[model samples]
Structure formats: structure tokens, C-alpha cells
Target: MNRQHWLTAAVLGIALPAACLSACGQDRGGFKQIDQSFSPDASVDAPDCRHQCSLDGRSIVEACTGTVVETCPDHLACGGAKCIEPCAAAAEDRSSNGCDFYFQSPQLMKRLPPSCYAAFVVNTSNQPVELSLELAGEPVDVSKTMFLTKPGSATLLQHTGPIPVGESVIVFLSDASPEMPRNIEWELSYKACPAGVTPATFAQTLTGGTGVGSSFRLQTNAPVSLAAMYPFGGATSYVPTAGLILPVASWAKEHILVNGWEASESGSPGIQIVASEDETEVTILPKRDIQDGEGVKGGRAGRPAKYMLGKGQYLRIVQDEELTGSIITSTKPTTSFGGHSCGDVPATAATCDILAQQIPAFEHWGSEYVGVAYRPRLGNEHEAVPYRIVAARDGTMLEYDPEIPPGAPTMMNAGETVTFRQGTGDAFVVRTQDTEHPIYVAAYMTGSSGDGKTAKSYGGRGDPEFVNIVPAGQYLNAYSFYADPTFGETSLVVVRAKLRGEFRDVWLECAGNLTGWKPVGTRGEYEYLRVDLARNGRAGESFGESICQNGLQRMKSEGPFTATLWGWDYAASYAYPGGMAQRKLVEAPLGSVH
Candidate 1:
């Protein structure tokens, strides 16, 4: 691999200098405080602002700058994140971000690679799922599993494994009844260009009309969260991208797509929409002109085009043009995804891979986020990965801590996007001028060559994979995540913040201690660290059989944090955020979800 353009972080080992360590400062979450006595100046413009503790036991961080004038949500009073007011009390019904029901389906993604799907059902409810269920229900046999996250008791490591997927399936508790609404959450994983499949339908993507074409009708008695990982495998040109799967209750009428640039003969980049309710009407306003191919029609650039879809039906818009700024709105709640069928990161990267992520509605967007890269493309530690920030509202002014690469836009219009590379083995925080201006940020694993390895540090190790970076304010303290144990390697990146200038620790059930946290960037006093969870070269490889049952894990912390899961092999790899709080950081239409 080439090393000419990679950043310096000591190629062989990590070089965390003493000056990069935080000597003093409140280890609060992503919302950097002004010149408070507890921490150094987070902003030169607001050096005089400070935080005070109320006699009633609540924290109040006054805005130090004129630009910050937004009010906190009903549950929060001061500062911008859940970390500041550690002792504040408020009435919250946040049992867990799950719903009584959810609608889900599957996709083929690309034609070249044979695909297989797997799912991990998480018991987000406080009560244990003591019984076994099958079909669309959770396919977990509690006895062989590690054990679910228990309430008010010593933690027991649980590994329920991945549920097998087939046809259009429903995910609901067998015991669920209309009188008792239960919520559940699940993660979807796609094994790329796999070794083999017994039958062709094993990796089939739902095609054709309504009911028969529909996927999951997740009618639960409890709340549930949904997300997916689209991974492409083979000997080369394979990578993964993942995003939070928004439930129908949280869906909005409108959404904006974010993606990397790619216009090669090999793959095309574009947006896709899936209908939740029958007879859903969708309109697309493409950012660039699209060309026609296969049996699909093309939407003219700069013009609004409409399409009607039935429940479980999906639309794929593949083209040579970029779709980063495209806008899609529906008459009813719908699922929207964006990425390349198989393409390059910058149009010049030697190879290309599949990328697909379920996008959150515009209403779920946030202004504060922290973006970090994977360990260092397998072999190269100094490799600098790429990241992009997309604006949800016009006239958005972006601010970045520790500076940004030149040409990265500080001012952006709605549907506009800006790209910059992540610093060598580091993380960076980006926030809008205020809370009203929401944006979406994503991280991408650099693309590699045919050998599954590129020439330079920035070039290859794994292939191209991209994942949405859930903002800090939307981060949570608990997560039920799974890593595919079949890969040659599997690992996670855990990013946590401090509360009230005090240090906080997080625990991963599969692993001990959750230590060795290093500052994200040179600005250590900023109070953030990029910690590794699993970096071993191999993770007990499993073939096509029950993938998740072998790789499930649970993580917990005292305060909000973010975890990203990724795995790589010869030339195949996948990446996605483990979980997110995804709170109501921005305004949404009526009946939107967290």
C-alpha cells in the first residue's frame, strides 16, 4: 500500500503526546462549554460564559455567545446535551426508543454479489424474554444464548445470535396481544459475495408488487429500534455501510439523502425509497440529472417526479450522477436509503464497493456530532479515512473543533454537503451555529484495490464502506449490538464523554474494563476519546448458519456515548454505528419518534 499522503500518527504505534491529554476540564458530552472555570475555553467568542449549579440540584450553563439562543427540550433545561445537567430532574417516559410495530423489508443491493441476510432481535424491554419464538418472531433459544441485559442485577453476558431471514417476514412476540403493546429492536446484517448459498432465494431482494413483496410487519407488545448493515464480499472490492432504521412511527413525510461521489462504469450512486403504508405517494427532486438503465425510468435533473408505491414495495434510483442533495418526500411515512450500487469514494479511488444506509427523517437531524475513523485500515495505523457533513436546513453555518481541512464549507444550503478526511486515528466534533440548524454526518472506510489491499495508507486495507455518524446529543448510554463473527476480524470504536468535568467509564460485557481511551484530536481538554473494543485479527468465524447468535453483545455506561461496529477480511468488510439515542434534537412533523 502507498504511504505518501497519509497523516502522521506513528505508522507502527499510537503516539499520544502528553500535551494532547486533558489536564483540566469538565468531561461533559459533545456540547463544549464556554470559558467555564471547570474547562478551558471551548470557544474564543464565548470566553466569559459560565455554568452554575442550582440550589435545587440542577445544572445551568448560560449561553456565552449571541448565536446560541435556542431553548432546551422539556426534559432538559441547560447546556445542549444530556451530560451537563447530571443532577437535573424531569418527567421522562423514555422507556426505550421502541414501538408496538414496525415494517421492514430486504434488498438485493447489487447483482454481481450473491447476498444473504441475518438479524439480531434485542430485548430492549426490562422483562426477560423467557420463551422461544420462531418464524417472523425472534428465533432465539434462550438457553444457548449468553443472556439478555437484566434489570437491577449483576450483568450477565448475552449472545442471542442472528435470526435467519426469508421471504417477507414479521417480527413480533408470539405472546403479544392487542391489550399489551410490547416494543422490540433488531439489527440487520448482509453478508457480501459469500462463499456459497444452498438456494438462490437465500440472498434474494424483495421484488415485484405489494403484499407478497412486503417484508417485516413488526407488531410488538413493546418498543423496538431498527437498523441494517449492507456488506459486499468477494476476494476484492467489498465494503459495508450501515444506518439507523427508523420505525414507521418515527417516519416523516420528507427526507434528504447523503452519499459519497462515484460515477464509474462499475457502480452508480443514488437514493431509494420504500413505502410503509399502502398507496404512499413519493416525489423526488434530484440534485443531478440521472441516466436511464435496465427497466427503471430516470428522473430529469431539477424537476420533481412522482411515484406511487404500496406497502413493502421499494424504489431504486441508480445512475452515473451524484445524489447527495436529492430530496424525497412522501404523502405517508416511508423508508429512504442512499448509497452507491458499487462505486468509488472520490471518483478517483482505484476500486469501488457497495454502500447502503437507512436514513433517519430530516426531523431527527441534530447540530452537534463527533466523527471518528476505524483503527487504521487493518495494516496502516496512520491512514486517514474520509467523512462528510450534509445540511438539513438552508443557511447552515458549520463549526468544527481542532480546525478542518481546507475547502470544507463552513456555510451550506439545505441539501448541500461538505467532505473532509478524518485526522489520523482521531475524532472531530462538528456543530451548527445553533440548535435549529440540523445536519447529518457520515464516515467512510477508504477504498482498496483488487488485492483487497491498495497501494498507499489512504488507499486500501479493507474496501470502501460508509456509515452515518449519530450526533453526540442523540447518543445514549445503553446499546444492544452485534458483530458478524464470520469475518476474519471484528472490532468496535467506543466514544464517550465526561459529566460535570468528572471522568466516567463504560463497560462492554464481552470484554473487560473498556479502558485505553485516547483523546480524539490534539485538543485533549475538549473531553472526548476514541477507544477500541475488539481488535483481534479473528472472531471465531461462522459461515452461513446463524450469524448473529455467535456475535451478539450488550454495552452500558453512566452517560451518553457512541459505538461503531466494523469488520474486515481479505478484501471484504462492513461498518456501522452500534446504536444511537436519536432524540428529538430538531423539529419534526406530528407523531414523529425518537
Candidate 2:
């Protein structure tokens, strides 16, 4: 096997064993427990009105003919109490109600590495959606926004031009009221452009979009998948970072944060929160003292600090402190995102770039995860990258493939964190044995400077960036995603699951079949592939071939799979999952919402 192609499944406590195919055996799927059978047994009628409220009992509605639960999660219509998607062709997939989405580009930097931001919204709905862009504190032409009428079609949210990097500016988007029943997916991006390029010269996707903005909130009447890019570096260079934006429906009151690479001088890695409802009260128990930033007050470590934000308003904090394991609980659903302002990977690498990921609420944290290493700069043999692990509960224990530094390390308490690097050049996997004690992991790309001499430079190989590792249990069968045109290279990393010990085929709309998927670890059911997109600079390099369209593309497979987008420019880069089902895999112990 090609050395760079080998991957591992990293379990919690950050354990990622080398070649688990034999050891993983048939028990790989049991890493976590997921109750997908949301419906009651068919042919068994409801006992009576008295038993209707039992988790698996008939609904309280008069009919009592369908599933016991009021609604089937993952959008399924129950048949004889079995949860299934509606086969009857209709205007839209009736399983999702994720219409309202809110987005805010994080404060990616505090200094030089200048760049711009952009947003993409893909129409996954069956009917045309009259879409519009909304924002305040800045003004430009908003009339260029168009109506999306076809499925799989995408459009750029129109904007005037690149806004300077500072506090995030708010952008709002939504579908026409009449088009309430719909589904859409959106992605936000940033491209490395010349410092003084005219407004007309900025890079754009195939579908010319509304330019870049700081933050955006969308209130449509359909379900939508969203993601964003966090790129900040000198003009012509960057370190791209991305996040799989979850639907607002899954946004919750409680969250535990895991931020990326940190260096004191670059600026602090921090949190950005946006209010979804009026007069929302949010309290933060910072793991480190938060240095106050725009609209946010600094909070003492381990001390509770409160802030109030109105609907659509947001708070951004970037400083020198590390915010990992910080606890944030809000009174209403509020969108939250976090990442490092700008820092070098391995600290000594040449220049610095940004890192950011939209934080999934504690309820959405999954137990089973595969830690696939980002592609190393081919020919450089620059194989090793950094990994950070954060524990969500007390007494969380973890083990890894090959132990290093604090051998057999474990989190001594809830909200504890452990940071480590992979055995230089080796790709590892980390899995959690218990679902009740789920954890969060962030994968990081090292700096471009091989020896730590360069600084404030552009296009120095790859700089720094990070994305949260989405768990295997949250993989989806199909995805509508886009790659930012701003980067010189774009690729998708896929983790495929097995069915009865056989690997299934994955299809990328333009690339036909995704070939060269290697088995992951020791499990017969998992495989991993890192395919460069159609326009990647290294398109024809063996396993590095472009698998599909450069941007605004679609992919599907016979079984569940996870796709993460990665892109890079001079010294710039960004990465984020295509999308993931926001499952409530782990929940707060009863009555303890925070």
C-alpha cells in the first residue's frame, strides 16, 4: 500500500491503531450505539391511549396508525411503524424542516495575511426558491440575487466586494415565503486575491455570486445543509479551514468548544455566537480567560460570564487565550463558531493562516470517529500533523494506536483536553468505546515553512488550518457540496462504510466512479480515499487525480459515507466536512442542561 494512503480509525482518548483491519474485525461497527429504529413494530397496534406517550408508543393523534414517535428523525415516513423516506415522488423530500439557517464568517485574523470571504447556496429543493441576501452595517447591490429553480443548481450570494478582516459583518438570506416547503444547502468561502484588485476582478465560482461578507442569517421554509471557509493570509497565499454548517433546528442551548492552532502573537482562538431568537441570554464558563473582543466581554477562566444578544446579532472574540473545553449555554437556539485567529502549525513553520469550525452543540457530538490525515505535500514527505482531543464528560478514558508523550493518557476530569501529534508521517484513527462518553477531535495541517524561518509571507507551500472530525455514525449517503475557486487545489476525503464485509461504489457527478478507495484500519466495513478535484494542480498524479467538477458538485454512493472538502493556495488552506446529519448522539445527564 502507498504509505500516504494508509488511514486509521481514531477512537476516543485519541486512540488510532495502526492497521486495525485484523484487530478491528467484525466489531468495528459497534464503536458506538445509534438507535435508528425510531418507529414501533408494524402489525402491532397501539395498546391504548394510556401507552401512547411511551417513547415507542403510538402518537397522541386520533389516528394512531403510524409510528409511536410524533415525528421520525432523519425525515422518514413510517409504514406499519417502520421509519422510511416517502417513495411517492413529490415536490420535496418531506423528512426535513431545516429552513432557517444563520451564518457568520469568523474573525479569521488580527493582522497582515489579508483575504476576502464569499458564500454559496445550493438548491436541493424540488421547486424554485426565490432567494435573497440580507445584511446590515454595510450596503451594496442586493438586486442581483436570483431564483434557484433546478435541483443541484447553485448560486453565489451576491455581494459588493471584499470587506476588510476585523469583526464579522452580518449577512441574512432566505427563500420566498410561498416557497416554504423546500430544502437547500449552502457554503461560505474566501479566496486569495491581490490586495488592490478591482471589485470586478475577484475570483468567483462557475455561478457568479454575491461577493464576500462577514456573517449571514437565512430564514427559509425548507431544510438546508450549510458549510463555510476560514481563510486568512497574505495576498496570494492562505491556509484554508472549513466547517460543516448544521441546520439551525439542531442548534441547542449548551455547547462545549474545541478550538484550533494557537500562538500568542497571532491572536487568540475564540468563539463567535449569533442569536436566533430575541433577548437570548448566553453564559460562558471559559476554560481560559477570554480577552474581550467586539461586542463580547472577557470572562475569567472557570468563572461564569453572561451576555445578551438580540435575534440576528452576533458576538466575536479573538485574543491570546485558548478557549478549548469552554462551556457555552444559551437560553435559545444560537449559532456558534470558533477557530484560531491566525497561527503556525508546529509553531515554527514559516507564515500563519486562520482555522475555524462551526461548533456542534454537545447534543450533536458523536462517539465513533476516523482520523484521516490531510494529504501531505507530495514529494516533501512532510507527513505528520497535529491533533487535539477534548473530553465532554467526567472520567473519560482514551487510548491510541501507538502511545506517545504521557503514554496511556486519559482525561482526568470533564472538559479536560489533551493535545498531541501523530507519529511523524503515520495516519492514525481514534474511536470511543462508549457512546455515553463521546469526545471531540480537531485535525490540523502543519505550517509551510519546513524550518520556521518565514513569516508574513504568501504562497509558502501549506500554512495552518483545522476542522473538527465528524464521526462515522453521522455519515450521509449523498451530499451537495462546492469547492472554493480561490484555492489552487481542491480535494475531497471520503470515508466509506462497509455492508456485510463488502465495499460499495461511490459516484461523483462528474468523475463517474470514485476509484482507489483503500480499506481503513482493520475494519472490513470502512475505507478511505483522498481524491483531488477536477482542477487541482496535481490532477493527473496517480491517486491524486481529480474525481469530479472543481466547484458546485454532487456525490452519492450505495451506502453511507463522509466527504470533507480541502483546498489550498500559496500559503493558504481551508477544510470542512461536506455535511453530516446532526444526530443527538450524546446528551447531558438528565436535568443538567449545561
- Each prediction's TM-score versus the true structure: 0.66, 0.70
Error of 1 at 131 (Å): 11
lDDT of 1 by residue, 154-218 (tens): 23333444332210111221111223222220011123323221211232232211112334443
Task: Count backbone clashes in candidate 2.
Answer: 48
Q: Model 2, stretches more than 4 Å misplaced?
A: 1-97, 108-115, 136-141, 145-215, 230-240, 292-295, 380-382, 399-412, 423-427, 452-459, 499-502, 534-547, 590-594
Q: Give candidate 1's error at residue 34 in angstroms.
A: 10
- TM-score: model 1 vs. ground truth: 0.66
**How much lDDT does each candidate structure score?**
0.49, 0.51
**Alpha-carbon error at 218 in model 2, in Å?**
2.3
